[model samples]
Target: MSGEVADPKPGKAQRRRLSRSLVIIALSIIAGYLIIQFVGQIDWGQVYRSFGHVSWWQVLILVGVLVLRQTLNAVPLATFVPGLGLNHSLQNDVAANVAGTVTPPPGDVVVRIAMFNSWNVNPVDGMAGVTMNMLNFYAVRLLAPVVGLVLFTVAGLERHRVGWALLCALGAVVLMLILAMVLRAEDWADRLGRGAALQAQRFKASADPDKWSAAVNKFREQMSDGFTQRSTISMLALLAMVAVDSMILLLALRFVGVPASALSIVLVIGTFFSAYPLTAMPLFGFGVLDAVLTAAFVEESGLHYEPIIIAGLAIWRAITILGPLLAGAVTILVWRRRSGSNLNLWGSKDTAPTLSEA
Candidate 1:
C-alpha cells in the first residue's frame, strides 16, 4: 500500500482545469488577433508624438483621478451590504471584477459569494447587495443618454444625433419606470415575474410561473426596506462614479492634445455614453469598444485629430480597463494569502463555494 503507484491519467478536476484553460486560451487568442488587426491600421508615430508634451504632473493628476474613480465605483457595494466596510468592499469588488473579466457567466457571482463567506457575511445578503448595485448602476447608465440629449439639444448640436439619443432616452425612461414599480410594490414585482415566466413557458415548458413569482416576491421583500430608504444616496454615488469615469476619458483626450476647439466636453461625454453600453461585452469590450470610441472621435473632430483621438483612447483604456484588471489580480493574490486558500474562480470543491448554496 505504501508503494502504490498513482494513476497516469488525469482526474476529473484536472480535466476541468484543462478545459477551462483551453477556453481562456482560445478567447485570449481571438481577442489578441482582433486587437492586433485594429492596431495595425493606426499611425504609431502620431500617437507617440501626441504623448510627447504630456507633463509628468499631468500624468500624476490623471493617476489621482483614476484612484478617485475606483473609490467611487466601490461605494455602492459598501452602501448595499450591511457590516461590510469600505476597505473590505473595495477588495471584494475588485476581486469580483477580476472574475467577471476573465470567465463569463456565473464566475463573478460565485467569486462574490465566496468572498462574502470568507468575510463571514451572509450569502443571501451578498447576492441581494450585488443585485441592487448592478440595478442601480444600469439605471444610471441607461438614464445618462437622456441627460446627454438634453445638453446636446440645449447646445443646438446635430439634429441627427438627437433622434438616436431620444430613442435611447425613451428606452431608459421606460426601464426606470418599470424598475421603480417593481421596487415600490411587491405585487407589481410578483405579477411581472409571473408574466415573464408564463411568456417563457410558451417557448420552454419547464418554466414555472409560481416559482418565478415567489422568487421575485422574495427578492423584493429582501431589498424593499433597504432600497427604499437608501435609493437616493446609492443612485447619487453611482452617478458620481459615472461622472468621474467620463472625466477620466475627457482628461485623457485633453492631455493628448485634443483641444476643446476640436471636440467639446459635451461631444466627448456624448461619445462616451453611446459607447458605454459596449463595456458590458467580454474583456470590457476591449478592442471593439475602443475602436468605436476612436472612430466616433475621429468622426466628430475630423481626420486631423485622429491620431490624438487614438492616443487619448489608449490612455483612457489603460487607466479604466487595464488598471482595474491588474489591480484586481493583485487583490485576488492578497485575498488568497489572507484567507489561506486559493480562491479558485472555477469554484473547486475544496477551495471555492458551490453555486447551489448561493
Candidate 2:
C-alpha cells in the first residue's frame, strides 16, 4: 500500500531562522549606507566648533529635560499596567527606545513585549499596556500641529505650511476615531482578528484563528477596563512629554545662536513631529530627520546657517538617541547580572515564544 507522505516540520524552524538572518543582514546594510551618507554631508570642523559654543549650563538643562521626558513617557505604562512601578516603566521605555532606534517598525513593541514577558507579566496585559501608550503618544503627536496652528494664529505669526498641517491634523483625527471605534466595539475587534487570521492562513503563515479571536477579545476587554480606570493622568503625562521634547529642541536651537522666534520654534518643532513617521525607519530617522529639520528651519527663518543647524541637530540626537541607547544598554546588562542570567537583547530566549507555541 502506498503511504501518504507527512510534511516536514524541521524545515519550518530552519526556514524561520534563515529568514530572520536575512532580514537582520538587510537592515544592517541599509543602516550602514545611511550612516555613510550622513557623514559625507557634514563639515567636521564646523560641527566641532559649534560644540564649543554650547555652555555647561545648557548641557545640564538638556540632560534634565531628557530625563523628565523619559519619566513622562513612562506614565502611560504605569497607568495601564497596574502595579507596574515607575522604575520598571522607565527601564522598559529606555530599553525599547534603544531597540527601536536600530530596528524597523514595531521593533519597540517587540522589545517591550519580550521584556514584560521576562518580568512575568501576562501576555495580553503587556500588549494592552504597550498598545494604549502608543496610541496616546501618536494621538498627541498628530493633534499638536492643529494646536500649534491655533496658537500661532492667535499670536499673529505667519502660518507657513498651514495647508499641509491641516491635512495631517485631519488624517490624525480620522485615525484616532477609527482606533476608538475598534477599541470600543468588540465586534470590530473580532472582525479585525478574523480578517488577520484569514490573511495569515492564505499566506501559509502559522496562526490559529480561535486563538487570535480569543486574544483580540481579551485585548478589547483589557483596554475597556483600563480606559475606564483613572487614565486622564496618563494622557496628560503623555502630552506633557511631547511638550518637554519640543522645549528641548527649542533649547538646542538657542544653543546654536539661532535667532529663531518663538513662532518659528513652534512651527519647526511641529514639522519635526509630523515628519517622525517618515524618518523613523533609519535609526530613529537619524540623517533623514536632520536634513528635514534643517531645511524647514532654513525655509522658515530665512537663514543659511547650515553648519550651525547641523551641529544643533547633532547635539539633539546625541542627548536624545545616544544617551538613551547607552542607558538602555547599561540597564540590560545590570538586569541580566542581577538576575544571574545571560539573556539576549530582547530578553530571555523563551520570553518571546514562537507563534505556534504561543
lDDT (Cα atoms) of all candidates against the true structure: 0.75, 0.69
Error of 1 at 337 (Å): 2.0
Clashes of 1: 0
- Candidate 1 clashes between residue pairs 3 or more apart in a chain or in different chains: none
| lDDT tens readout by residue for model 1, 175-239 | 76787788779889989889999999989999999988887787777677766556667778776
lDDT of 1: 0.75
Which 10-residue span in candidate 1 carries the lowest summed lDDT? 347-356
Best by TM-score: 1
Error of 2 at 287 (Å): 2.5
**Model 1 regions lying over 4 Å from their true place:** 1-42, 52-56, 195-210, 347-351, 354-358
- Cα-based TM-score, every candidate: 0.79, 0.77
Across 106-171, the per-residue lDDT of candidate 2 in tens digits comes to 456666765666676665576678778877766666666666666566656575557766886787
